[model samples]
Target: MKKRVVITGIGAVTPLGNTMETTWNNVVKGNSGIAPLTRIDSENFQVKVAGEVKNFNPADYIDSKEARRMARFTHFAIAASKMAMNDAGLKVGDNLDGERTGVWIGSGIGGLDEFEEQHKRFLAKGPKRVSPFTIPMFIPDMASGRVSIELGAKGMNNCSVTACASGANSIGDAFRVVQNGITDVMIAGGTEASITEMTIAGFTNMTALSTNPDPTKASRPFDKNRDGFVIAEGAGIMILEELEHARSRGARIYGEIVGYGATGDAYHITTPAPNGEGGQRAMKLALQDANITTQQVDYINAHGTSTYYNDLYETQAIKKVFGDHAYRLAVSSTKSMTGHMLGAAGAVEAIFAILAIKEGMIPPTINYSTADEELDLNYIPNSCKETSVEVAMSNSLGFGGHNATLVFRKFN
Candidate 1:
């Protein structure tokens, strides 16, 4: 028999707030984290808004000297991992066996800020002037490496970089590790700090980012007037432990990770497969893996990126998977407020799904006004909803046609 896996702790540094509790509170109130882009000079760029993490002080979580050596995304990951470890009440080499603990963090684009800076320095000053730590700080897998070192987790340490699905895939991969009895505890999530000038310019040139000047109304997923996603930055980490291991330590359980499904579209580098065929398969596979019927799913945390193609195709995918039941299911995109966190999006949204199960409240898709004719579903728009969600699923569709789904059920 496969071992059951449960989420014992969660930590986040998001545009909504720097911590999980504060972020959840703001989300429940339908707060918008989008604001004027201050991370880069907006005057030179067409995109003017972003969901930037505010009031984040890395020194609060990492030593000043050590923090300086890592990239911003790594800082967010390390901080969130520490917070999750504290929340889980499992200390490596103390309450938990260090050899049985692991870390699997993902980032779609790791340390782009550092890469750009070093590239500039190399161009202006020469390669000899580049920082020696650039390689370690700029790679996508460094977040997991740093977390494992900091936490002293000696088990599996890995990362998944499937664009936006990176975080959800990391969690799903870690869940399987525990479920298969390979590890007792795993720290898994996603992080990204790619809000640099190059990233903004690149996304803007592709017209993948919203050009709306007003931050409050920029990210309106499923709305007819929605333009595109607002690029954002942050990290979200969760502690997943084997069920019996958690119960033995008297750890508080948040939700059970029952199923995970991942598939590749094998069709596009950026756009999703026509009608979301890949996503449909992912959701169906997740349901089959969970051993549940379509009617059993009460809520869906959508991968609504506010893009023209994503929202339409995702709606189609949900309809394809759930059929008539899709209309009855409550679906909302927390990205409507948090903006698109790139690699960190899936993991952060997964936390929202878990929270909905624990708190019995669904976060709203803010800025949703005019409805799109093609997309008709209960988006729980512009306002929070009080509902009892027993089984919730989070969908993450990434570039390169990666589709990942994770199903969470109320831990009975």
Candidate 2:
């Protein structure tokens, strides 16, 4: 029998808050994190609002010298990892077997801020003006590498980069490592900090961001007014441990990871397949892996990025997979509040789903003024609800047609 995996600790740095408690509190309050762009000059841009993590001082987490060598994404990842490790009562350079504790983190794009600065320096001065840390700071895998090096985890160090699916894929992949006896404990999640001029311009040029100037109303997922997704930045990290290992050490278990499924649409790079075929397959696969039917799914944290295509197709996919049972499911898109975290979306939403099960409360999908007639379901609109969720699922669809689903069951 395969070993079971459980989430013992969690941490986050998002637009809603820099720490997990503050973020979760704001999320539960149905507060919007989206605001006017402060990270970059937005006076001349069509898309003026985004979800930016505020007041994050890099020197607070890493030394000045080390901080300069890492990208903003890596800095966020390491900072959150430290919180998660501390919450789990684990220590770097301490008693745990370094061979059994690993780190798996991911990012959609790494060090855009660093790359932009270095490129400017190189153009202004000469080639020697570019810092020697430029290459290491720019790579996507540096987040995982740096966290592992800092924490002294000698186990499987890896990164997942399936665009928006990066975070969930990384966490799911890390669970498999411990379930298969490759390790006993794993620190895993995803992070993103690509809020530079070029990054915003690229997404804006592609018409993928909502141009609505009102930050509070910009990211209305499932609402008819939703123009497009609002780009956001942050990191979400969770501690996954073998069930027996957690119990042996008296670790607090938040929830059990029951199943995971990842698939490729093979249809389009940016657009999802018609009617969410890839998303449906991912849900079905996750259910099969969990050895349960669609009727047992109590809630779903949807990949509702507020885009016209995603909200409609994802709703259709849920109905297709669950049929009438879909009506009984409480589906909410926390992106309504957190905005879309891009690569970090899945990890943050996974935490939202798990907390829903733990707290027995369904978070609200704010700003749901009008729902499409074709897409009808219990989306927990506008207000949070008190509900008993036994099993919850989180969905993430990424660019390049990658679709991933994860199921979390309340541990008995």
Candidate 3:
């Protein structure tokens, strides 16, 4: 029989807060993490605002000298992963076998800050001026590599880079690794620190970022006036352990991850497949993997990026999959508040899904003042809802047409 996997611990460093509880509490209150872009000066840019992780201190989690050697993305990953391992009550080389505990973290555009800084030095003072750690700091996979080294994880260390779906894909891949009995535990999720001048200008030029001057009103997902997504950065890590292993250690279970579905939209490099066909298939596939019908899904954490196509197409996809039952279930986009965390979006949102199940409260899609006619759903708009959710589904659709869905059920 396939091994069953359960989430025993969770961690996150988000725009809302540096720790998971602070972030979750703010989310439940319909608070907006989106604010004026302070990470970089927006004087020369059209995009005036973004969701930036405020007041974060890497030295709080990593040694000051050691943290300097890693990129910002790796810093976030390490902090979150350490928090997760602590939450799971497992220490370095303790309570778990290092050979069987792995790390899988993803980044869509890893270390853009590192790259920009190094390139500036290279131009100003030649290649020799560039730090020797340039490659280690700029690579996407470095998050996983450094995490494994720091945490003593020796099993399947990997990274996924499928745009916004990177986090979910990494978690899904890690799930399979444990389910297949290749590992007993996996530290898996995604991280991103790409909120830099080049990334912002690139996304702005493509009209993929919100140009709204008011940060509070910018990321209004499902609202009729949403222009584009406001990019953000963060990391979310989860400790996924086999049920038997968790029970043996008497670990606290958050929820059981029962299903994972991943698909690609070969139709476009930057847009979702027409009518969200890929997303629809991914959701259906996850339900099948979970052996549950559409009616059994109580909540759906949407990949609602607040863009025109994503909001409309995702609504269509949900309706197509659930049919009339779509309106009956609650669907909300935490990105409406968190902004789009890019690679970290899925992992953080997955934690939100599980929290919704555990706390019996669904986070709201805030800033939803005006709604689109065709994009109607419960949304739980502008206010949190206290409801018992037996099964929660989180969907992540990314650029390059990546679609991923994960199903988390309330543990008995």
Q: Which ten residues in a row have the lowest lDDT in candidate 3?
A: 88-97
**Candidate 2: clashing pairs of residues:** none
**Order of candidates by lDDT, top first?**
1, 3, 2
User: Over all chains combined, what TM-score does candidate 2 have?
Assistant: 0.98
The clash tally of candidate 2 reads 0
lDDT of model 2, residue 53: 95
Candidate 3 error regions (>4 Å):
none
Greater lDDT among 2 and 3 belongs to 3
As for TM-score, the candidate ahead, 1 or 2, is: 1
TM-score, candidate 1, is 0.99
Off by over 4 Å in 2: 92-95
Clashing pairs in 1: none
TM-score computed on alpha carbons, candidate 3: 0.99
Query: TM-score, each model?
Result: 0.99, 0.98, 0.99
lDDT by residue (199-221, candidate 3, tens digit) is 99999998999999898899989
